[model samples]
Target: MRLHEYQAKSVFADAGIPTPDATLASSVDEVVEAAEDIGYPVAVKAQVHVGGRGKAGGIKLAESRDEAEQVADEILGMDLKGYHVDRVLVEEAVDFVNELYVGVTMDRGEGKPVAMVSTKGGVDIESVAEETPDAIAREHIDPAFGMHPYQARKVVYDAGVPRELARDVASVLQTMYQLWDDRDASEVEINPLMVTDDDEIIAADAVMNIDDDALFRQQELAEMEEETFEDDLERKASEYGFDYVRLSGNVGIIGNGAGLVMTTLDLVDYYGGEPANFLDIGGGAKAERVANALDMVFSDENVDAVVFNIFGGITRGDEVAKGINSALEQFDEIPKPVVVRLAGTNAEEGREILNDELVTVEETLEDAVQRTVEYSEEEAQ
Candidate 1:
């Protein structure tokens, strides 16, 4: 549920946060028109979900309408980290004397929302942290009380921003916190928050990621879903009712729960393997769900081996076995070898049923992961 930069900026503007005037363009002509409307010296930014756009040359400065059209032509069809850039944000460029970073995100360890601020901006915060950890200031806000004005003021001042702009920045932080909390967002960030020569503060960039679980409450936000860039496998997986996240590794992982899926991925890494994707079939692992999960994992060409680790408590092991068989029947060819580890309720019966199948079954989780890793390595060789 990550919003594009333009979408996030729209939310920010609605929250009374000052930001650059921007227009969404889906074509070169639209971009030129937007630049003409915004009046020159605009920034044409690729509206992709991933980061490092600037490093990838996805962000270009256009000094005039003609330059805007040329840059848009070059960027519109360009690929950024495997995602095709179909749209660009044409925004009025501004001159600023200072840059800062402000963001609010959930802290799972603290079970609260934390506000992160730094005077150093317009660059990757991770680089700043690795080079100068002290440059970033973090303050956790109590969920019960929310982010008070005084707390935000303290965070802003601690970041070493000038005294004149501290209050303005603090106010923007408070607004961002409110927007994040009200919208049930996982993150709300304003990178390179700028202060012009006139001492006016504005948000130069906005990025927001909403909590998918809370989408039921925000129907308006839910309707804004855009599938223009999603791959065929991802769309199909969503239609089949499985939580799937595509990754870059060679091992495909499927489990009954998120915790188990994550643990299985870690184990794969521990066994010297990389997980290609995270596919969670949820707590109720019916045959259809299991089949859907398997189909999705096998759909990935990067998967050299598949691992199904299920500790069936709420989900029965036999049902999962049936799903695997169903998936095998549905697909003419499975791309990789599969390893299964079934434990808990009716595990023995499931193992007996899958014994005649082509899948390799292991009695222990570690053994299953080790075998998958070995199989992947052997296949690669």
Candidate 2:
């Protein structure tokens, strides 16, 4: 679950991290009042879950009440990356000389949590990593032994942080680590941690994502999942109780396992086709479950064609085929063409049972993916 900037900042401030004083407002009047109370030169920021807010005109500086009203009126009720903005954060602007980045996340390859610090901040860290890999310093922490103060100090030093502020930066890094550990968070980040001319450090932005599995024990964080859904498709996927993720593309993908679904997505990309969604029906899915999955995918306006990639193990190929046939029959007219690639148990029987008019069966995954891409492209044209 991803937390909005205001929520993340609130959590950070409670954990003793220094943050610029900010007020949450849901209207232009509230923003003007907050700006007046917090003094001039405030920032009116859209409270949305997506990034690139500043680039999208979702963030602006307000030096006076008139400016605050203008910014708030423009940002509120605007669509930012498909998310509707209903609130804004009025924050006291900071005057800083330098910006830095600090974050902690799991390094799946290393099987440990990694702490990273970079002097090149206030920008996309991924871009910095790709262009100048040496600019970011990393330290992997073992689960047996949590991150130590020394490790934090070393990371800042290696990142070329100024000596006079290294201690304070290390302290903030340590606190962030503690928060990540105690809250069962998957990631914690502070971009553009500001260094003032007076030698004081303050966090200018916050981005935290909690582990979904760990939310069972973290009740407080679990309650913060209200506005995380990007659209109605996501909310419907949740209601349907399947593993579904919406993506930007025209090909709708469905498989029986997580690995199979991910592989299908990759193959679609390799074939120069964009996948609109990833829907894993899991092991031993019944006809109704498959129908539900199809319904969810077909609801997405971006999906131009559908692909069913099933390598039956515990999942029966014949059952999957029957589900596809049943789901298609429900439509008054075929919503879109479907491509099915079936392997493993009952593969031949499954292929024979499919409705050829609605679905084209391919014996190989590569053939199936390529055909699906072509189908989507044809639909687009």
Candidate 3:
């Protein structure tokens, strides 16, 4: 899961990493209050999930209380990369003599964590890799041994960090690595890590994405996940005990397993249909969970039709059928069509239970996909 800048910086501070003193504001009055408290020359940053906030005018410098309020009014409720900004982080605007980039991320190829450093900061790091690969220094860190202090210093020095600030930067890198490991983070980045004229180092901008699979162990981080998922559908799905991923398509997909859900997506594309989402209800789902899954998928405005594909080994088809009936009955009216394909344990009984005019029941996956596509096409007309 991705974290907003303020949330990521909170994690950084929790790990003992220094960051600019900041306050969260939800209103213009709050922004001015924070700015006044933090002193003049504060930065008002939109707390959205996407990057390029600065380029999109989601970030502004306020040298006074009035400017802070004005900037706050402009940023709050403004759309950044399709996400509405509900809050802003009012931070102390400091003068930095130098800026650097440091991050710890998973190296999927090597199956280990890697620490990266670059002199270039406040810009896209991928662009730096593409334009000038030589400027970035990367060191692979073994999970067993952890990141050594010497290894951290070597990366910063190779990136040409000045001798006076090398140790401080190195310390920050180690703390970042520790945070990544301790939090089970997939990635942790400090962009434009700045050194003030006084030679003090601090993280000016932070980005972090934690591994979803590791959330069970990181309860605090899991609780904090609510801050990022503002969409009602996404929030509801999390409340339910299932996995859901949004997609750009007309056909909403609900399947029993991850593998089946993925294959269903490929087949939908092959059959000239787009999938609106990937929802896995998991094994042995009951009527309530099934109802919850359907409710979540139907909440997406883009979904024109829904496909329920279940191969019941541990999950009985009858249970799924009951769930579908319950959901459809609860709603006074359903504008979209539903295609259900059931196999394995009590499939016949399940199909018998769901003999409704609104639901299209299919005997095979191919038939279900074709019917779903046709229904979506019909809905478009």
Candidate 4:
């Protein structure tokens, strides 16, 4: 689960990481009041789950009450990457001489926690990584030993952090690591760890993502799930026993496993089509689970066509067909076309069962993807 900037900052502050004074506001009046209380030269930042807020004009500096109110009013209802900004964080602006980046994240490939420090901050770290990989320094921590103070120190120093502020930066890294460890977080990042003229370091912006599996042990973090869902469809899908991720495309994708779903997405893209969402029903999904997956996929209006690419190994093809039929019966009318490709166990029987006017069944996976994309393109016109 991804935390909003203010929420992440709150977590950081609790872990003894310094952050600028900030107040959450939902209205122009609240923004003005918060700005007044926090003093002038404040930042009016739109609170959205997505990034690139500044590029979208979701962030602005307001040195006065009138300016603060204006900026807040402008950003409060603006859309940033499809998220409607309902709140703005009014923070006290501080004088800073340099910006740096510090973060700790899980490295699944290495199977360890990696602490990364970069001198190039206040910008997209991905861009920095792609353009100048050497600018960032990394230290991988073993689960048995965990991250040490010296390891954090080495990362910052190697990243070219000022000598005088090395210890402070290392301390912040340690605190960030602690938060990540304590909360069972997948990622904890402090972008633009500001180095003020007075030699004080503060986290200007923070972002964190907690591991969903670990939420069982984290009561407080589990409670934070209320703000995680972007829409009712996603929330409803979570209630079911499937994984769903909404994407901006016309073809809805449903597969039995994560790898299959991902491969389907790649094939769709390769064939000049875009996937609307990623829905994994998991292996050995029953008819009810398949029905739920179909319901969730059709809930998305953008999905012009849906492709069910199931390589039935442990997941029986006939059961998947029954679920599709059930879902079709539930809907009053076929809102969009559905393409199904059932291979492996009982494939022929599954194809026979799905020989209905409601869907088109294909013998090959590539054929199914192509037909789905073609149907979606035809639907567009």
The models' CA-based lDDT, in order, is 0.87, 0.90, 0.90, 0.90
lDDT of 4 by residue, 300-362 (tens): 878899999999899998999998998898777888899999999988888889847899999
Between the candidate structures 1 and 2, which one is better when assessed by lDDT?
2
Q: Rank the candidates by lDDT, best first.
A: 3, 2, 4, 1
Clashes of each: 0, 0, 0, 0
lDDT (10s digit) by residue, model 1, range 1-381 = 988888888889998999999999999999999999998899999987766788898999999777987999999989776567888999989899989999999989998899989999889987998999899888899989999998999999889988999989999999999988999999999889988999998888898989999999988777776533565567777798788887768898999889999999999999899988888888868888888788778767778899999998998888888888777776566568899999988888888777445689999999999999998888777
lDDT at position 147, candidate 3: 99
lDDT (10s digit) by residue, model 2, range 1-381: 889899899899999999998999998899999999999999999887666789888999999988999999999998775567888999999999999999999999999999999999899888999999999999999868899889999999999999999999999999888888989889999998999999999999999989888999888878877744356677777887888877768999999999999999999999999998889999998888888888988887778899999998888889989999999999889888899999998888899989998889999999999999999999999
For every candidate in turn, the CA RMSD to the true structure comes to: 3.6, 3.0, 5.3, 3.6
Candidate 2, run of 10 with poorest lDDT: 226-235
Off by over 4 Å in 2: 226-230, 248-251, 269-276, 301-305, 325-338, 373-381
Model 4, residue 93: distance off in Å is 2.9
What TM-score would candidate 1 get against the native? 0.82
lDDT value, candidate 3, whole model: 0.90
Scored by lDDT, model 1 comes in at 0.87
